[model samples]
Target: MAEKEAVEATVTGNDQQVGFRAMVMKQAIAYNLAGSARNDANEIVHFTLQGDKHRIDSALATLQEGTKRSSDIKIATTSAAIDPGLNAFTIVDWTSSSRNITNTYNLVFELRADDTAISPTDAKAAWHQILEKTLNADDLKKLQPND
Candidate 1:
């Protein structure tokens, strides 16, 4: 309950990071979501996600799936409750970095749903799906430093 409103979830990946914001302003717009991205000092990224559960979900999916550069990555998600007054779901601004762990970065996200906010559990759920699409065992192994 708590009058669900927004969902702020954080993501972690390879030595780089990025975030997504600005709710799906354009009706049925392309999946090309927009926001900000950066390189954190902690080797971990910090990004935000602002949009409906579906929008954020799909975007996160992309992150998990990854691009041509990076491959499967280890991730963690922490959820936060939001207000119920937001008109539409929109990602605000993302703060990323590359110093979370060794050869890893931090990922932070702020998302909006219908009434209340999405719980960390739910956030991780969505993030988990994204990771599944993006990462694999080899990707996770290579990120490790020389043992």
Candidate 2:
């Protein structure tokens, strides 16, 4: 059997909202690796790839190539402990309500209430309520510049 290894990589650049996570997942699956990818609020994508060391290196090279939608891709990798229980590659969504709808809609919704079980509709409604209460017409007028 081949030697197995794992690596955690942080990719910085124009990596968000560009199908970058999906591309990483596909490459990891193709390499028979197990781990995950996620995007942070700062627009960086992180990856955990575990399998054969050589295959991981290959995937890293391909990652350097970047997707058509991604540019200025830069990756820094570190050794990681192999996860014997991880059997597939997946995308880990950021756990924040402040994320834009494009990224938050399809994943789990997290809020100050600490309820991850809330449906998307409920989450949206909760956010709307918070905004309505916090930013009434008077508040908006106050925020406006005094002319």
Best by lDDT: 2
Candidate 1: Cα lDDT at 20: 24
Model 1 misplacement above 4 A: 1-5, 15-37, 83-147
Q: Give per-residue lDDT, candidate 2, residue 125.
A: 53
Model 2 lDDT, full chain set: 0.62
| lDDT of candidate 2 over 52-90, digit per residue (tens) | 788789878988888787899999999999977776565
- Cα lDDT of model 1 overall? 0.36
- lDDT (CA) for every model shown? 0.36, 0.62
Best by TM-score: 2
Could you tell me every candidate's TM-score relative to the true structure?
0.38, 0.63
